[model samples]
Target chain A: MTDARDGAGTAAPPSAREAYRDLLPALMRADDRLYCLDSDTGLFDRAAFAGVPDRYLNLGIAEHNLMGTAAGLAASGKIPFVTTMATFATTRALEAVKIDIAYPALPVRIVATHGGLAAGHLGPTHHALEDLAIMRMLPGFTVVVPGDARQAGEAVRQSVGLPGPVYIRLGRSATPDLDARAAGTGPSAGEPFEIGRAQWLRPPGDVALIAGGPHPVLAALRAADLLAAHGVRAAVLNLHTLRPLDADAVVAAAAGTAGVVTVEEHWRSGGLGGAVAETLAERAPARVARIGMPAAFAERVGGQDDLLGWYGITSGAIVAAALNLISGTPGGGTDDPDLSRV
Target chain B: MAGRAPGAPGDPPAADLPAVAHRVREHIVGMCAGPEGGHLGGSMSLVEILTVLYFAVMRIDPRRPAAPDRDILVLSKGHGAICLYAVLAERGFFPVAELAGYARPGGRLMGHPVRAVPGVEMPTGSLGHGLALTNGFALARRDRRCFTVLGDGELQEGSVWEAAMASAALGLGNLTAVVDRNALQITGPTEDAIGLEPLADRWRAFGWTVREVDGHDLGALHRALTQAETDGAPEAGRAGRERPVVVIARTVKGRGLPSVEGKVRGHYARLSERQAERSLAVLRARRRRAAP
Candidate 1:
């Protein structure tokens, strides 16, 4: 596992797909029971699986069968890593995943790509905005959204021994590597990443910016920088694991702060924002300003970054939301419906 | 009775099949009489299929249901879970007395078959997933055989066809699917809901070896299943005949009980105490008339 970051520390890291292509082959080779099942994703190179050709299978463009077959393999003592687009894996094959995998609590890892607005140019038909909510609701499911390529590899490696179904949401484009050591605060600042534990990228301050996925986490870091310029100290938390959430970290982050602001590349109602708010509502009361895609579908199509900016999921939007919460503004806590118009 | 433990290796004598099937049917009828009732029609239709698989066909051990190399049987049409429970109990997977607590509170047996039940390969109340699951089992260990019984009505799901295509494409010769072709679902006749005519041809088109048989005939079912198991063997693979097999078992819904036989109402019913006794009487009369 070579570091994707370069000496300059500004090199664009590999996308989640590239990380899987580099990581899965070795993982499969080390564990004979691990099989890779693809629904014609065409992401991994055939040469990479040359050693384990028999274990790698492309089930064609059938997500339903892909999931069901993975469940069957899991039940038979083989761990199957299923790969497909997020939309198809969640919506198209939802029933199969629920009944065949989640209901039985099988050990099938669904590493879905092009999550959220990653497939923005392909239009709404390809976007997977609702996948997190759907997968999180399934009983015995572990939902993890890796903030970068490195975390994606870690997620795939850690999920191999998990006893139940796991859903790993990934993106289609490259994202900057998120190194907590750069922030130089929190006890876990330099510790290795662990699933279900939040990574504190900055010291606790007046407000905490909580987010998951590649762009949102990076945006949260940038928002923390922007908040520093405004003389308001802000903490950035990479809440990669949605299920089995790090509620303790969330509650602690909200203890002395004005409130917490959540950012994600998904719908405002679910995903990281909903998970944060739901945890805080019961454990600790805090004002939350959720910055994400609105309830309506994308009215205009663009690249991943363009769509994120248009939907108010950028660092600037996060700064605005944090400032509003600090000032005790009433309507700033919820999603801004007017952002969808742009 | 054969002097061997239940689910012991080797097939029981052919003469014993009818008696075993008869007892299984009795168990189903009795269980359905419980307050919740069971999927009477589908369960009754599956009596011979389950009996033949558990008794004369598959390689399974009641004492070691999870043996690494043992054959697998998934009741894909999980509404017919009662038939599987009855057959498993009779085969010594569990005590037959446990059948009484089925669908009752605190009972391990639910309306759908789950892994909690012994000898059930996978929980499959949802239609259209069994074939794909069997494909997985077959692919995981090509040496062992895997089987699943799907309802004829379950063919309406597009996922079934998706699995059908995959089974053939993967050349999973160690896999066999038996369709309980009772030709009816809860809504009405399968044809009325969605016609699956030329069913055998459809399976053949999906690259499978199709064998249509009378589901009630123990001899035919036994033969079809045996041939399927043999055909799936790697050594039995001919030059161009390495294909998965589907045994279409044509059966009548609610076969033994004359009142609900071949009727829509037989799909599900809560039998009164009198109704249960009457149904058992009809089954006994049929057995007596068939005897020498």
Candidate 2:
């Protein structure tokens, strides 16, 4: 498998959490209604909030109260950005999000970090593999899984004027910057980033590889390059926004390609793959192969990259899925039924 | 009742609070008599608490419900939404006739409170969320006093304690919480469900100023709320009185309805027309007995 950093620059890309923290001070300056609430995630530096000490609050380890208080602030005409681990935010504080935030449609931005296997080494308890699925199912919620750090900042900025609750999923570690590399190559390249719009990183061709979150998207881009070497042109679609999903983009990608492959660091049942399959099943039917974690928790302890590789969430796995999808195979890539080594 | 003139709009005299509470209870019973039953027990218990807040304690205007500086009240124990609705209507936030539409199809009033109704600061039904929201309001605008009403049963929710810790840690002097200690829940007595016996001690432990009062005593409620506001005032902070206050108002779950008073069945009921009439008669008889 080709490393995502093979030909990339030496400087490491910023993690989505880092990008969000760096953007907080500016966001606070831009809008007086903006406030930051943390559930002791330790993702932010207290020094950045020195000038606006009252605005930045570390609410300790209570995610439930963190979300409810953010909703209350939003109800009082303040836009509160709540930070917590994705698993805790979605699972522990879910009812608070559904009632206090989504039910009233308050403008609370829940920027959850360590989405998917980003916290893999801490074991399955920390991994947020179900965050996207849980958030997307909520009504009046704008769910966004940024493909890179830059897109994460863009998602946070764009969520200000957007009425209602928003859930932004971020990875713990730095991932490749797919947007910078594909800036001038595709038709949708150089266009302004929108919350619900999908970005076409590679031109539509024989197969379409759609993905979201940092690693899955980078893997899709790399998979496109690998497919090109095998004379199999693959299009890459960065479907960042899960809810209020750009169905037109999904349908168009499916219509222009022989098959569609969805890759994500999530369960194959729900997340990005389930959304795309649901879209294509209704709008434009096509052969779809989903590349993601199977129906089991991580059995081995490892870093995010190790867990992803063990689960076949890699560029090589995406290439295999794309080839199998185009060849009309019954099962493709890492959509394996065997869970012996899960 | 004829000798007493109606008080001014926002600041009704403390003398008029009981009459206002009686009318609010009548409205709650009427709404509970509708096709869809309401939370009768909890709503009945909260009548005086909400009545005093809307008619006397809180500074709010029905015409300008969204005034930025206006004091806010969150009905955290949302099952008592009918009680809050009746108080809001009596305070002229909405028409009293609108109470008939409660819990009916296509009506804005659902089982719980929502922002669609005027004067409702936040939509709430799920327990343990109101205090945190109240903390948000207090934190956002330090000048305005914020209040919330919680059920003794609701204290079982862990988030309530979490909010309590945050409230004290932030020194939210402009925040007050009134616990409707009705001693009953949907299942049975609150103590049987989950004991909150040392409830005042719990709040004190959480670093809040605690006060226990008779929830049905409008004057006591009014005094406690006023003192809470004063204690939570910003100037009070300079005077070393910077803690949020909680009034644990001991109340009977079904205060107005004699048949279900303090019974678990009183938690929710869709009263028949006859039952509603008897309940009204009981309230009138009690008022007549207490009259001068």
Best by DockQ: 1
> Which residue ranges in model 1 land beyond 4 Å of their true spot?
A1-11, A180-186, A332-336, A339-341, B1-15, B228-241
DockQ of each: 0.78, 0.74
Candidate 1 structure quality by residue, lDDT tens digits, A7-45: 112437678778987899899999999999988888977
Show how many residue pairs clash in every candidate, following the order shown.
0, 1
- How does each model score on lDDT? 0.85, 0.85
TM-score of every candidate: 0.94, 0.94
Alpha carbon deviation, residue A157, candidate 1 (Å):
1.1
- State the weakest 10-residue window (summed lDDT) of model 1 chain B: B1-10
Give the per-residue lDDT digits (tens) of candidate 2, residues A123-189. 9999998888899999999999987788899999999989889999998877767668687767798
Instruction: Output the lDDT of residue B143, model 2.
Output: 92
TM-score of 2: 0.94
